[model samples]
Target: MRASHNQHLIHEVLQWNGVIARRAHLDLSQTIGRMLRAGELVALLPGVYTWARWAGDPTVRLLAVAAWSPDAVVCRLAAARLTFWPEVDHGELDLAVSDRRCSAKGFRLHRRRLPPEHIVGWPLLGEDAATDGRGIVPITGPALTAVDLCAELGGEPIDRVLRSRQARLADLRGALECTAHRSGNRDRRRVLVESRAEPWSAAERKGHRLLFEAGIGGWFANFEVAVGGKTYYLDIAFPHLKLAVEIDGRFHEDDPDQFQSDRERQNAVQLAGWFVLRFTWYDLVDRPKVVIAQIRAALARCRKLAGIR
Candidate 1:
């Protein structure tokens, strides 16, 4: 077939692979090349191809990559994306493949012999099967992909994965429930349950909660206090004691404008007689007890000074 004609055929196949594949006797190579040259297809892996920008769906790219290596299973952040895990960025691509001989361009590959239970159908990919470099194929379903990613990445990438807003507890539970009857990896599943038990923003919340839990209640969260009619919110506060806490995220240091604004707020709060306690992510994560103790002591001092104790 001519490249243009082949490109047309390829588009037809991408839309409905089984129908076109059975109708066209054209070799896969010529069709794939035409699709690539025409910018009608993106090579996800060596043999797998998908319509370029299939609505900017990462799953399409994932499936295309998996199509190139039929044995390849989507994993890691890519798998998280498929499962709708929150906080996972769509930019990174990850796949697992069993075939050592198969390799692809612009993909991160994990080689392993995935059992049949790990593989599942994709109704959206137009073919029930995933594409191997040579033909359409099947791969790990969203649930298994999510489980595999959580098991593989542990806690390190959990923050980013959660941030993507794709993966949710409901989806993770569904994936885990699907594998409930199967044996092995019970510990890994337990880890997933624990890791996801709290929201990814747990650290931020915990910093605020620690003060209240430590009997330093009466503090407002994101409490808006104004001076000169300009209002600002405090991460944590004790208005009665004229105390405020500000959680300094890393972004505060990196952005100069934000840093300056923060300084202005600090100055304004000080003029209002509010003693500010600034904490960082490191303080929240590393020294929770110390941070809470400091706040408790500050509260005591404030009470004494105000004759409230």
Candidate 2:
């Protein structure tokens, strides 16, 4: 009967938080310890235990890592994701630890002493995370994450964040400026400078250069249009021809909100009597000839329609 009770207790905790720490199992008599030995519960880390069923879940694995390293702040690719920066799905967890060596399976460790201002403490997933018995996991702020990622992985994500208007480049510049005294900040600073000069997507940048080199004229980057009582911006626009070009990246397909918003914006642009041309990252980079041809063809058609040629 006691064994049955222990099994129920272990299952309950696992269901609630996906994992349980040794300290949390202290109150459940010595049953949890026996269960660990019996292989009913898997030790994900040193003292963190999860139901064998949940041990394979990536999110649960990350939470286990978080539970193991209480003092470390979530950083790197993981931090970028939490801060809404564009990135591919990361396979391993990343954490920034200041002191007291920290390591775990499925985790990449980074050594850095972050300032309190740059660290944001929040529940593991959301505000209601506490209800699931998950503790707060400190994450690097968006600006710091942006700078860190830009330094290491190029500034495409930073440009995405800027174009989305979810964050300000000036604030990122401020963060980068403040961190100038830190080690290996030169690369980050250089990336920041370049971003300030061209604050948009890689596709847009390449498209703009292609158009310029092709001697295309009378077009604006990020042209603003008002339709359906809302203001929308085009990635690139030829005002006289009422033609707009949009450079899309993977994030549009991955994020439902962005996907829906793009659809609405495109519909509005069409209703406003504008000819919209769309190109993907591959379209702009891998097939510049095709992109240029399409734009030139569209512009010529527009000119004919408007009787300008």
Candidate 3:
């Protein structure tokens, strides 16, 4: 094959996640071994090769692994990285394969075939978009990926996927049902059940649980509040009393910009007659009683001000 022809073949295979196998280019097969030896092409598997340029791209590596493993559907952290949250474990690759005999190096394989409804192409789908998995690398739907990772990540994935609007509560319930027969599923069920509040982050999830266990109701998670000309989403809000509970996660401590913006956001809400209470991970974890007490006190004070019976 000419150098240009070699580049063409490599680009072709890389784009498909190795969907177009080596045999499809038999006319250039005679030149492949030489190119591999010359370092112009890199072999992902015995029969899979891509241009040397893409050998280091993380996504290319993921696709190469998928191409190497027959019937591989990206799942778990890999699925989340591809869809809603990109900052997850970038190098961890997990795939689902129905083939009993399938295996791949450096990747975890779940040996169950997902139902068609449980898989979608990369970039994710809207809550109701239907698909036939044509012309794309398959990935477990956001709901299935969230439920699958619950045992490892708790309610975080469930919360994030729902917040992204790529999956519904029913979708998560259904995914849980699909995995109910598997062992070590109690955590999955617990996470999904706790996620009914649709908390946006793990800290918010924990905070919501604190309120739930204390029988604190009437608070909305990620409540939208419009003040002045801007909009803000309160981590947790009591609309009736105009009380906002802000969960300050790691970002609040590390990012000065976020800290500054939060101050501005709080100023706006407070000016609009809202009472705000802020809590950190330590407040929630190390002093649950104190957190609850503060919330109860705030509720009482707000009620006194609002003259609610």
Total colliding residue pairs, candidate 3: 0
TM-scores, in order shown?
0.46, 0.69, 0.84
Error of 2 at 218 (Å): 12
Model 1 Cα lDDT, one tens digit per residue, 29-111: 76666557878666554455566676256546644553444466666565554444635674656666665665555566666
RMSD of each: 8.7, 5.6, 4.2
- What's model 2's TM-score? 0.69
Alpha-carbon local distance difference test for all models: 0.61, 0.77, 0.78
- Candidate 3, residue 150: Cα displacement in angstroms equals 1.5
lDDT of 3 by residue, 156-212 (tens): 788788879888889888987876677658988878788888887888988999999
> TM-score of model 1 relative to the true fold?
0.46
> TM-score ranking from best to worst?
3, 2, 1
RMSD of 1: 8.7
Error of 2 at 213 (Å): 11
Best-matching candidate per lDDT: 3
Model 1, residue 165: distance off in Å is 5.0
The parts of candidate 1 lying over 4 Å away from their true place are 1-63, 66-73, 79-92, 96-156, 161-245, 256-276, 281-290, 298-309
Q: After superposition, how far is residue 98 of candidate 2 from its true place, in Å?
A: 1.6
